[model samples]
Target: MKTVALVYSQHTAQTAELGGRIAAAWGSEVVYLDPDTTRLEDWMKYERFILGTPTYFDGELPDSWDEFLPELEDADLSGKKVAVYGLGDQQHYPVSFADGVGLLASYMEELGATIVGETSTEGYSYEHSVAERDGRFLGLVLDPTNQPELTDQRLAAWLEQLKVAFAG
Candidate 1:
C-alpha cells in the first residue's frame, strides 16, 4: 500500500505548500483537490495518509475539507496510519487555533486509524483549541501568518518525528 498526502484550501497556497513539503519529505504522492474537484477513492490502497488544510471562519476547516470529510468518514480506515497538519492564525483565532487539524485528527481517530505526529503546545500562544488533547496538539500546527520563520524548523522536526512513527 502507498501513502498519500492530501490538502485543500481556498485562500492561500500555504496549506498546499506545507502538504507538498510533507509529501516530498516522506517521498509520497501528494494530491491537491478543491471542493468541486474529483473525489478521492480507493482508500484501502493507501496504508498511510498525511493531510493538511487551513482553519476557516472561527476554528472551522476550509469548506473543501469540510465537504470532503464525509467521504473519509465513510471509508473503512481502520488500522491505517494518519496524521494532520494545518495552518491557522493563532494571534487572531486563539480560541480555535488549528482547529482544522483537530477536526481531521478526531475523524481519523473515530475511523480507528493510528494517528501520528502529536505536537507539543508549548510554542503556540493559543487560549483554547479543539486540536489540544492531553496537552498536545492533535497533529502538526503551523502559523505562517504569525511565525513564518519557524515553519521550516517546525516542519523539519515534525517530519522527523513522522519518519520515526511511520517506521514503528
Candidate 2:
C-alpha cells in the first residue's frame, strides 16, 4: 500500500476529530499531519493524501488552510493522488456547505494532482454546494453537528474507495 498522509487543521475540533477517525480507519499506512506544523517539504514524501478542512464564515477555508496555501501552491503534486473531505453544517449553511472541500480540491487539481474519492450527494439535505459536481460531492462531506450518525459509514466507504484509487 502507498503511504497516505491525512493532512488537516488541528485548530478546528470537528475537523480534527473527523481526521482522527479517518486515520484510524485507514490503519497504520496512514499518518496524520497538521497543516499548522507540517513543513511544505514533508508533504512531498507522501504520494497519496487525504486533505480535511472545515468550512468557516460563508464557505471560507479555515485560518490554518489559508496560511498553508502558499506552501501548497508551491508544491509540485504532479501525478499525485489526493482526496478531500470537509466539515459543514448543511442545516445552517446550506448555501455553501462543504465549499472548503471543493476549493481545496480545485487547488490540488490545478497543481496537477489527481483528485479522487468523490461521493454521492444522496442523503444530504443541502440547498447547494460548490463541493457538488455533476451530482456527486468532490469528496467526503461530514456534518458532525447535524448528521453525525452517518459519519462512520461515510468514512468507511470513502476509505475503501481511497484504497482503490491510491493503488492505481
Count: clashes, candidate 1: 0
Candidate 2: regions farther than 4 A off:
none
Residue range 1-168, candidate 2, lDDT tens digits: 988999998888888888888887789999888888888888888899999999998999998888888887767899899999998899999999999999999999999999999999999999989899999999999998898899889989988899999998
List model 1 lDDT by residue over 16-61, tens digit each: 7776677667663444445435354644556667777788879887
For candidate 1, the 10 contiguous residues with the lowest summed lDDT are: 29-38
Count of residue pairs whose backbone atoms collide, per candidate: 0, 0
lDDT of 1 at 16: 72
Considering every candidate listed, which one attains the maximal TM-score? Answer: 2
Candidate 1 wrong stretches, greater than 4 Å: 9-12, 28-40
Looking at model 1, residue 76 earns an lDDT score of 69
> Looking at candidate 1, what is the lDDT of residue 32?
47
Best by lDDT: 2
